[model samples]
Target chain A: SQCPQKWKRIFCTRCNSKRHSRDRCPSVWRVYLLKDDRPKKRKKLILPMHSIYCYNCGLKGHFGDDCDLRRSSRVPNEDGSAFSGDNLTNSLKKEYFQ
Target chain B: SKDEDANILNMDFPWTINRDHSKQKEIADWLTLEIRDFVSYISPNRKEIELRNQTIGKLRDAVQHHWPDANLHVFGSYATDLYLPGSDIDCVVNSKAGDKQSRNCLYSLASHLKKEGLAEDIEIIAKARVPIIKFVEPLSKIHVDVSFERTNGLEAAKLIRGWLDSTNGLRELVLIVKQFLQARRLNKVHTGGLGGFSIICLVYSFLHLHPRILANEINPIENLGVLLIDFFELYGKNFGYDHVALSVMNGKATYLPKSNWKELHPIKSTFQLAIQDPGDATNNISRGSFNIRDIKKAFAGAFDLLTNRCFELHRAKLKDRQGCSILGNVIKYRGKARDFRDE
Candidate 1:
């Protein structure tokens, strides 16, 4: 008797990875706080590959929600065909999915 | 002079989205470092760990001296190494007697604990679903909860230990999430909040299914900040709670549609959070957590606050970024600090 092998299918449109869905992509931007403690010299960190740009303002540093600039026409239309930043934060991305 | 220079340097925020090409990675590194510091801050020290061991030993001696057939074992967060300061130690007794949860046995243990001067503020709850005794160890001042013949917790502790060994950031994430929920009073299952087991499952599943993690593209240690945000986003805003359920069975994390889970057929609420119990296939671990709405809302709020704070801090002048904390808004621990445990 042999065990059955199940193939799990996952795809992330955000980072275009076949290993995971859009919800888990690393292209999504996140910011954290800095501690006030010591440690004079900090070591450099290895970064992931991220090329995602903000959908609203077409910026690279931030996402749609954090985009301070006026909403641009680059937003996805009703047909879901235009520039799709699938990595947008949930509050902004949920309606896009619906 | 060096210290002053370092202080001044620290006051200036080094990474910004506009300035740094790998701003996301920088943020992840910062978050990972902060998570490590927070876990180290809240973890039990040598003195605390020694005290707990002594407490457990004294408890085992007292229980066995009174009932030669009974043996006590530690379980729950204390056993899983996921407990915060002032958290209660969960214990379970194994006895040959079938009626250990009976009122007579409960009162007997309470009496023995009282007589031995090992316990104070002893309260026996015989009418609850699982009859047990709760008390504060007089000398150590540590709260303890003991149940009779309930080995499920002990088993769960072993499972969590295995998870801790296998998962890279399980302990750090669990501790952070635990503190976050505790701060908001959303960690208690009795009050309809998520319990320790369910919380662990949620984090475990999130880590296993993360795109970068799945593809071996990111080191969990270097990318905890973005991972943490993704966790909140998945649960807070993206997860289809009304139609989907969570499962972490067999080390494979997945989201199962409600209709696909045959074990959850007995559960009536279609909108409830359903997490399949790894120990028992037929069980839903999160059935007791009825406050899914509040939990989801809190997670969403955390996502907003973290992203907003990041955006503001990034846009702020370097001088203005001084003394700001990103995790402080979500997790606030003002209690007595503990010495960092030697690895």
Candidate 2:
């Protein structure tokens, strides 16, 4: 017989959900800035940043330090700015710093 | 037996690190597979685990024989299932009577172990903060440490079990980190090295506080390779050791600045690797680990090695990539090796 699954009565302080834990909570984004159990509400409606592309690995989910793929020799777009380091960092700060 | 022999032979030929991958996702995918394979390769197999269980059983019987009320309880890495090969088994003798820690009790148990032939090389350390009997099981040659009347190790083991159960990819990352530290002889606690518990907190905090993980953007299992590098980079080069402390209290893992920790623990060292003990907030779990400089430098070196190897492999010709291992640059598995991807 299969062993019974371990029961854990956990409360997610981030989103105040019992169905999920804090780390897996959908409402928990950038937990480093969390000051208390009641996470501050974002001023702007935050969309999933998975679409943000990384020039290093040519992936859409991450960029900068988050991108561990080997650095590409050239950017995909030379003339048109697909994304800029300053813009990415600024947007990230604005979204996560609230 | 034939397959085992073939695997032993495979160890002689070094494993390959990477193949041609254009996207970061592809490399991440490759790394995830390698991490899985490496963990399985180094992990104790069924026979080895069974031997540990039998060893524990023998010690338990011996303890109960002497004191019918006393019982031996396995704790630490053995109990948590996070142990690497050759790691000593940690146990505590629980009894209603509080005299199990006396000098006489320690020597009596040591003598009993010697007479029974179940143990050898017995050493009774009575002057320790916690009196313990250290011995090696004659049959398995496995080292074991038995302490008297302690429940803290058991509690810590249970906490780790809860973590391993809830967190995805925690075991994989922990095993890799443990092996990495073990290779450099930096895993010993008495010598001011990062112990198993401290390493767990480090990886646990990194996983929980990672921007990508917290945002639910990347699956950790799919991105173990990248996460491994980022782990090194954060702890090695970026983490503010003097200002930042790690915590896993109330099932929430996060990095707390030292100033905030100072409010709770005013007298604690400000520039040390302070991981607040989960059981008691006032106590620092990583207080014994004093070699922060060496640990940080080693982690930074690993980050450099992994990134440099990844870059070199990315630019290498297909023929040059043969038998090159990126993870090998950091952790060398001194075990019978076999390629799992080929199977």
Top-TM-score structure, candidate number: 2
Model 2: per-residue Cα lDDT over B1-343, one tens digit each: 3355554554522333233232333444546667776776656777787888998898899999989889999999999889887889999998988678889898888888889998899888888888898999999999999999999999999999998888877899999999899888889989999999999988887776566565444567766887787688667765556655677787786556555675465744344688888899888888888898889889889976876676566656667765556687788766544333332
Model 1 ranges with Cα > 4 A deviation:
A1-98, B1-25, B266-269
Give the per-residue lDDT digits (tens) of candidate 1, residues B116-230: 9988999988899988899999999999999998889988998889988888877888888898899899999999999999999989877765534543444676667767776
Q: Show model 2 residue runs off by greater than 4 Å.
A: A1-94, B1-25, B262-264, B267-270, B335-343
* Worst window of 10 by summed lDDT in candidate 1 chain B: B12-21
lDDT per residue as tens, model 2, A2-97: 644336676777657576655544222111212122436433234345434332333345433444543322212221121222222344556633
lDDT of 2 at A43: 37
Q: Assess the local accuracy of residue B168 in candidate 2 as a C-alpha lDDT between 0 and 100.
A: 79
**TM (chain A) per model:** 0.24, 0.29
TM-score, per-candidate, Cα-based: 0.74, 0.75
> How would the docking of model 2 be graded?
incorrect
Candidate 1 residue lDDT tens string, A1-98: 35342255778776567754565434434432322214464332222213322323323333334445543332222212112334333343443344
